[model samples]
Target: MSQETLSIAGFNVSPHHYIGGQRVASGELFDLHCPIDQSLLGRISEGTPAHVDAAILAAQAAYPAWSALTAAERKPYLDRFAAEIGKRADAFCQLESNDAGILLSRMKHGVIPRAMLNITWFAEHALSLQDRPLETEQATHIVRHDPAGVVVIITPWNSPLMLATWKLGPALAAGNTVIIKPPEWAPLTSSLLADCAHAAGLPAGVLNIVQGSGAGTGARLVSDPRLARISFTGSVPTAKWIAQAAGANLVPCSLELGGKSPFIVLEDADIDNAAATGALMYRNAGQVCLAGTRFLVHSDIRDHFVAAMRAYVEKLNIGDPRDIAVEIGPIIHPRQVERVKGFVERALADGAELLWGGKPHPFGAQYFEPTMLTNLRQDSEIVQNEVFGPVLTLQTFDSDAQAIAMANGTDYGLGGVCYGETAHATAIAEQVRTGFIWVNSFGIRDLAAPFGGIKRSGIGREGGDWSFEFFCDVKDVVLPKKPFRASFSHR
Candidate 1:
């Protein structure tokens, strides 16, 4: 290991972090760096197939006690965990902001606080247990929610802690043992989360973590027969692989993948309001999964919308992650920066006009200027793919019906936004085919709502009680007064 490598609890580490029952130190290694400065952060030993096996075994071993404990028993641990997280909130925010190239101010004020809130939400949700009831002629029956066996949680680099907590909190609160695989690119917060749990006196082996890429570590975890469920947040290609593995093992899996969500600016929409709200696409440098990359504006107001958007993007300050005033940070990696640039180039070649920003940022390795492209072909790669960068493609539609149709034309149906007069936006929202749609807003998510995608965006759901169902199993217990009936209709 070089000076760029970090020493964690004695061993030299990579950007990736792992926490198996016994510490591991083998297999491939990945370099972690700051997305803004490209400075080496650390290295993590990429786990092998053997490592995944060991992790699954450890999780299986820990399941009994971890699942057997009552909600009352688990409450204190997460409560303490949340308190500790709050204590070091500043450090956690700083680490994530630097590593992921997220804006320091937003990370400190928005992302970090929301992550902590997720922990608190789960802690409180654990205390309240509610079940649905079914009525019958003879008697009443209730559906009981019980924890599934072992759970495999795979979280992506974008919004690492917040997304991980969304799965980790519910899975743990539901009493299922968990095995987490943090992204190699952003493992600091994941390690910090494990540390938080450890400091809160969580039992060893209850929440196991292994560091590695999606190919070996994550794939093996989902495929392991010991796992009863897999909760994953990543790309669509990887989600398909996880789904295949889960099917092979006959285990349930929940996936939340990429999106090319549309943000429609209706004819009657307030141009200023729409522009301001759509600016969130550049937030976190557009690394968010639910970012609105497709801007569909009604042709009647297309020119005005584009002008407002251009002005908004040109004003965004792009630079160091440490800058308090800088709203847009880097792309989180050189590869991503290159990918975003490539898309812009392709758009240019395909006859799309660059409305404002679209180039290597003046500052860092991962930085790309907030870019806006108009007159883009609907068939262009930039319009079809999820360009996870601070870039947006503006498209126009003749009618509200046409806008909704175009918005839902892709294989993805993750999220969308409708901006217009109150009545019109609400009307458009109804026709937009997405799991979540914002009225006059973009990228707004809540812990209480059901969050997920439709079609290619990914399957199943996350957040609220919906996620809890993924890690639970239902058993039908019947006590009949007469002999059991075999009729299709339970008469």
Candidate 2:
């Protein structure tokens, strides 16, 4: 059965079903846990080595038929796929918000539209595939783009539906069959997506969903010899493990990993704008890999930025994610809350002053107030490590060189921001070692441009064209039979 055909409750009715030649959910079991309340969502059939073998077999069996379909034929499937998603869009959003502990407003207003746009972007790009022209001096030259066989997309829980679409959209647009492995913490949205795909009349084996832990199922998907490509988004440590496994199998993999990005406020930057933009660091409870976790301010304007930032953090409404005005929700889980607390405690121990919202929320239970810590030492853990929560650390720089140094000192370079006028911020953004940089904003992204981290942030690009390119192989054919070629050697 396809993910699209799954039950509304989010469990695969027959996780052990066979597609093409592969078997899924034979003897494996995976429990989906709600990150919001730590309740059990449901259990999916666990994927084992034998199951992985079957999936590879199924993908290989279906590849030729799926690939042979013309772009026009594939176009309808995409339209139907999107329609299916639209059918249960509300259910999907609710599940995603619940699973990620993100506000429903953000999910409905931000994530869903982006997910739909991703699909539309891929569909539009699919029709414009023009082959490269050969030089007149050559008798014959051809450049063809072909799909990589048997792709595996391993997605994280943070933005389950949206992130999965990022990988799925381009992979399918480029005509690759994919097996998606949803994160253990949030499989509900994926299950709904799978259902949509099936209802859209996509071929049974064209898309599959396998649920399990990163250790077993993730390893199996990465190590399987039949997979030609793997696209993964998660922590750096997990990306490392995936890279190693993919290396052993000699398969190409694309990774979107961790980040400890910085936001630099120049001496000329408007303090109010910088402070307001810095608040985005706490978006999604600061769980985003590209969140601007570090603040590098000009010593001249540092105190003003800190004071305004403290006031903003204090004013945030912290409560249930379902509440409309709740600016800050509970973290994905209590464990994440504890992790953020540990970071705060460590920062205080290292002599950082709590500027605002240091303690847990007065309402209690998995919610932490939006927090800002000033007087943070340059080398303190709060400024160094990624504290993926509603916490921002303050640091001041005497010179532009010091700002650059502090920003680049971390292992991450996923994102950076410079707050100033157009020309100056653009120049500074150019110097930051990051895949994405904004002049006055922090986390804005467009589907047209490629998005990925530099350094430890990630290893590959994701977007419409960039993602399609990642899933394709280029083959060049040259013929030297033309009259203009004196040396007829074909390289």
Candidate 3:
């Protein structure tokens, strides 16, 4: 293997499509650079429509046998896949960190483990699933979930492996083969995922990887009629395109798109803890879709909360992601650095006050300071749009109703936070338009809980039984009573 190649599980990680358990290095290759320093990482095989067709063919061929297996029978394969991922956790972490400019420590601690847990949980949970049996006056009804056919999963650059496996686990557990189109910006870990699957002896064509631009590769993937469903996590604009394509084929889609989530702090909230939790939103340089970038605080305690948050934001050790001690790292890419700068410039132009860091960090072209904006109007571009950078907005509300209104004002309703005494926070949380809300806590997740958003955020949910339903086609069967009496319908 060359220096560009990463060998995991005796397989050299190539920047090429893995179709039917073989490395298909066809087509012209595109260069992948490390986000941390813009160094050549690998030359990815540019996926073509032909590549997509091949993947579809492979999935079609594998679906029959894979779906025929019972949940109990399939668990061993998924278990082994998780074991393989565990064996190469270090590589997964390092690759993801280098590829995304996220802290290696963060990936080591959170993302990779969650990816493995995703597989583990779905594998075990699938075995315990029971169809609901209902007794009616004249008949008995049974609702069963049957596997949909081959599905396509389009993932985002930020937390690619975790997000992909989040959908992949249930999609596989529900007995659907998959074609994953990892973002070209960070395609390394996904290729490694295919390697892990292969190492686990997952049958050929059961899982495939395609890499390339969204305009061609992604567009072709979601539009394909052969896919039973399309699951995507990315920007809202791209989701609209995916929806249009999926709609043309009438293929169902599960979209987890962008967010402008809010974190509210009432006067009665624990200011220090609230600030700490709010500061955590800047993780991964604010690349998270569920990040609560909009902070709303009670006017009575606004000044105090701002000071607390400013102090906490300063404590973050922004440096190279390779350094384990660094808290915040560079923006995912130079383009994103400019995006944050544009937002900061426009925010200041819109008369917003810069309470804390806003300039590019000294480390390199990609590094950015964690920025916080105060005195921002609700109509500001920085307030409504998804910055996808280490920038945040701070606003003050007079009443609970005002807070809820301001929080719900954005086009997104993904995830939100309400910080206050338990009862008040719960009350406020209930009024926000988001799909999920936490009272006093941020980033706390329950494995079985459903996660998605409303409005422009996204459609459909994923997790637990929700994932089962989304990944499988549920049908109801009606059985007549033993007497087999026919009854006339009355209207």
Tell me, by lDDT, which candidate is best: 3
Q: Taking the tens digit of each residue's C-alpha lDDT, what string does model 3 give over 352-470?
A: 89888889888778888898898888988999999999999989999988999999998999999989999999998999999999888888886799999999999999998999989
lDDT string, candidate 2, 379-475, tens digits: 7788878888888877889887888888888878788789977787777788889988888876667787889988888898987567777898866
TM-score of each: 0.92, 0.91, 0.96
True-vs-predicted CA distance for residue 63, candidate 1, Å:
0.7
Name the Cα RMSD for model 2.
3.3
Candidate 3 residue spans exceeding 4 A from truth: 1-12, 485-491
What's the ranking of the predictions by lDDT, best on top? Answer: 3, 1, 2
Q: What is the C-alpha lDDT of each candidate?
A: 0.78, 0.76, 0.88
Per-candidate clashes come to 6, 7, 0
lDDT of 1 by residue, 423-491 (tens): 989998988788888897665677878998898888888877787778778655455545665778755
TM-score of 1: 0.92
